[model samples]
Structure formats: structure tokens, C-alpha cells
Target: MQPLLDAILHGGPMARRRAMAKAITLLESTRADHRAQADALLTALLPHTGKAFRLGISGVPGVGKSTFIEALGLYLIAQGHRVAVLAIDPSSSVSGGSILGDKTRMEKLSVHEMAYIRPSPSSGTLGGVAEKTREAMLVCEAAGYDVVIVETVGVGQSETAVAGMTDMFVLLQLPNAGDDLQAIKKGVMELADLVVINKADLDPKAATRAQAQITSSLRLLGLHGNPEHAHHDDTLWHPKVIQISALRGQGIDTFWAEVSEFRRLQTANGRLAARRQQQALAWMWERIDAGLKQAFRQHPQVRRLLPAMEADVAQGRVPASTAARILLAAQFGKAPETIE
Candidate 1:
């Protein structure tokens, strides 16, 4: 393990890849020892991170997400960019395993020297991606990867969590999927930085019509509507919509060019730096919350006090809010002292 850790710090291409794979495996481990080592490795790797662009791709099931990523990833590698994909398949709560195997679909990219593909089980979390997805991205970047693509499970449910963590959120859609234009939730569409109309070569005519309908629908999303002729900022910027055939490798270059241009504009406008800062702050709070939860559970006094407080509330002897205050005070050994 020490040798592997050392290799991670100063290894060549193959060694680094090996270290990365080991690091990711440790991160995904449920054991405390593995987690501690993984945390240390991540701390060491943090400085080399934040140099790559992080993009999140999400959509409904059967949206060709895995296929599109394979095509796009290969394209990027051909352009001399080292690519890393963190594919998250939401785990089944009953069985706690993945049904859709992203790695199997992306066999080519998985073996490419310039590419690394990791499939993470979502562990029944609210976010489509796992909690460690961000950490995985950092590991890849630290290994000198140029681009990090996060692919979330294709469920049309709310994906605000993944969207908030990425530089750009790409929404993928198919042709003539039963008026998908009307069925898509507005909030989901608003989060999209780019929309790709995939499977274009399967049925060109149908794809074209579907593209037009989706474009028109997205345009409507960008318009501010009001009954009293008073319009608020009820719309977001229109996301670029591109037609692509991921299987045939059509329009991939054009799609990537648009994405690169959007990235450039975002950086020039200062949004990129701003977003990174926000993500950092969010991560800080997340860890703090996790630590607090762990501490509260492990502290002997809190463990004893929790049941008593719950019983008091249940029996109507104490209000739930009052119990919460007491618990907080007990856990911190005081009512939370404020610096301000």
C-alpha cells in the first residue's frame, strides 16, 4: 500500500493509472482503513486538481448517454486530450447494485491509455452521482487528465445536486419520444448548459423534426411570460442544441467545438472561477455536516441522551424543537457559541 501510495505521487503513465485505479477502489470501499488512506491520498492530490474542466451529463433512461460519452470521449482522446469519465449508475435500493453497466458499454474507452472510465454505484443517494464523484474527479485531474466527464444515471428525476457540482450540465435527448418537449420539467431544462439531440442517423427525418420541436420547446422555456404585461427574469439563457449520431460518430466534432467555446466564454465571463469557489464552500459544509453527524452518534452522552429526548417529544412532555435545541447543546457542550 505504501509503495502504491508513493507511486501515486511520483509514478509514470502506467503507474499513475494503476495508482488511480487503486485510489478509486479504496474510495469506494466501505472499510474505515481504506477510507482513511483514500482521504490522505486525496489531500496529497488536491493541489494538482482543479485544472480540468468538469462537465455533468444526465438524461432519462435509454437516452444514449453511455454511447454518446464513448463517442465523445474517443473524439477528445484523438484530439490529444486525456479524458476521465466518472459514470454513476444509481444503485437499486433493494439490491444495492447496478443494472445498467456503463463500463461494459464503454469497453473501448476503458482500455485506452488516454482514457479512464469508472462506474460508481450511486448507493441509493438522492444525487444521481455518488458522493465520492467529486473526489474521483480530483484524483483523475491530479493524475494529469485534461478533461473530466461525469455521467449520471439517465433518470428524468430532479438532478439539481449533480448540476450544482459541475461546470456545465448537458441534457441528452432522443428523437420523437412521445412529445418529450412537453413532458420535460422546466427546472431540469433550465439546468442544461447544452442539449444534444442524439441518435440522429437512425431516422434522419424524424430526428430533424424532433430537433425542431425540442428547439422550439426550449425557446419557449427561455421566454418570460406574464399576465399583467410585467415580466420578471422567469427564463434562463438558451442552451445550444446540437444534433448527433453517437454510434456513427457524426457531428461529434461540431458538438465538442461548441462545448469548448462555451467553456471559453464561461471562463472569460468569470463564471468558471466563481462556480469553483462555490463548489469548494459547498464541499466544506458537506464535510462539516458529516463530521457532526458522526461525532453526535459516537459521543457517549449524545447516544444516551438521544433516546430520552425522543421519548420526551413522543410523550408530549417536550416540543420537538425544544428537544432539538437540547440535543445540539448537549452535543456541543453548550448552546452553539457564535463568534459574531
Candidate 2:
């Protein structure tokens, strides 16, 4: 155990990666012993964490997300920063795991020495992001990675989950794709810290016009998106929209500059620390919720009561709510109100 701790604390690159991989596997395990070990590892590593910039990127399908991240990651590495990309792919419920094939898409970044790429499956989780993705980010930061990028499954609701975990949420889009005025639904647009219009090199003229149209539409909706920092004195947070061609590596440097500037503003205004604290608290509650669920499943009374409740509902002898109350009473061996 001490050797393992030393490996995690003072290991070289390969050793650090091995420790991180082991730590994540422990985090994902369902065994009680593994949970204890995982908690210990996180406790030891906690102080070494939180230095990396956590950025989340999401978009609709076919928004060239992989390509864009590769371009952006490589650019960051060239600036002498270590980068870690944690991509959460949509999972297959039938398989109970993800294909985790993002490495095939991000070829250049995957091979770069300064970049660490991890492709995690959604694992039937709502966010389509692994439960340990945030923990994984901490491990990477402790291992000396400077930037942590989380890429989420692109559906609107899934993107919201991703947003809660990230410092900056980037929504990517292609010009002229959705509806008239390059229309993205207002619900998704409201979450964007920055928007990127990709595939600009494919059709330059059309892309330019589409960007302008989308910008105009966003402004009309009171978005006025411009990637500005909102401090106590200023509540305006205007998201920035930039045209980029990930495949052609166009505008990536400028886009990264915007990201750096945003981070600087956020850190200066204390938003960065506040956001991290909020994320940590949310993580704690999530663990509590998961623990309660596991406890319910493991309790013998609850397990036995579940089938009986289903039968009562099917027979119309009792409403589902009443059945639920009875099950709760049985599970706790007390009145429902007392249980709560």
C-alpha cells in the first residue's frame, strides 16, 4: 500500500498513468473494499489536485467534436502545457459499457507526449459520462497535467450534466445546419460559455454568412454572446462565437486565446474557486445518493418488498403510491413518516 501511494505521489509519467488508471478502476468498482481504497487514494491526492483548467465541450452529433478537441489540445501542448482529454461517449445499454473508441478519432493528440486521452463510456448513466470522470480529473491534475478537457455526449440534456462539471461549457455547432437563421434551440444556447462554428474551411462563404445569421439571431434572443466575464459589478456574460475548421487547423490558436482570457477573468473574479467548490459539493451529494441507492438494493426487506408491490399495483388492489409507502414501511420496519 505504501509503495502504491509512493507511486501515485512521486511517479514518473508512465508510473503516474498506471497509478491513475488503477485509481479510476478502483473508483468504478462496486466492491466495498475497493470503495475504501478509492476513498483513501482520493484523500491522499486531493491536495495535489485543482490546478488544472477544467473545460467541458459538447455539441450535436456530427459537430466535429473529436477533431476540434484534437486541434485545441495540440495547440495547448505546443504552448508548453500538459493536456488531458476525458471524453465521455454515449454508452450501449445492452453491453453495459462504452465502445471507448475516441482514441481512433483523436490520432494526433493521442500520440502526443504532453497529452493524455481517456475515452470513458456513459455506462448507462444519465450524463453519458462516467461517474468517476470528475475523480479522474483530479488524478490527472495530481499527475501534473495542466489542462483537463471533458467532452460530453452531445444531446441537449446530457450537455447540461456536462456543464455542471466544467468550468467553461463550450457548445459547438455548424453554420446553417439546424433551422432558419442557423437556429439552435434557445434552451441549449443559454448554457454556452462559448460557441464554435466548425467546418469553416469546407464552404468558406456559406459558413461566414451562417455565422453572421446565427449571431444576429442570438443577439435578438437577448444572448448578446461575446465571451465576456461577469463579475459582481457586471452580470453580463456574453458567449463568444468563432469560426474554425478543426480539420484544417484554422483559428485554433485564437480560440485558445479566448479560452485563456476567459479563465483569467473567471479566476480574477473568484468565480473559478466558487465554481470548483460548488462542483465538489455536488459530487458529495451524488455520492450520497449513490450510497443510498446501493443500500436500498442491498437491504433484504426492500428486495423482498419490491416484487410484492409490483404485484399489488398490477392487480389494482393498491395504488402505486400506497404500495410504495407500504414497501418503505416494511423496509425500515417502521411507519413511513418515521422512516423519512
Q: Compared with the true structure, what per-residue lDDT tens digits does model 2 show for residues 1-340?
A: 5566677668877777777678777776769999898888888888998888889998766788888988888888888999988866555344332214557678888888677777664365653244677778878888889889988755436666677788899888886643464356557777777878899888877777877766655564552433332222343345667889998999998888888888887888788889889977987787788767778767799898788778889999889787777777876788866644
lDDT, candidate 2, equals 0.75
Give me the runs in candidate 1 sitting further than 4 Å from their true place. 1-6, 30-33, 92-100, 121-129, 154-158, 220-237, 305-318, 334-340
The lDDT values for all models are 0.75, 0.75
- TM-score result, candidate 1: 0.82
What's the TM-score of each model vs. the native?
Answer: 0.82, 0.85
Error of 1 at 110 (Å): 1.6
- In model 2, the clashing pairs are 225-239, 226-238, 226-239, 227-238, 227-239
> Model 2 — TM-score against the truth?
0.85
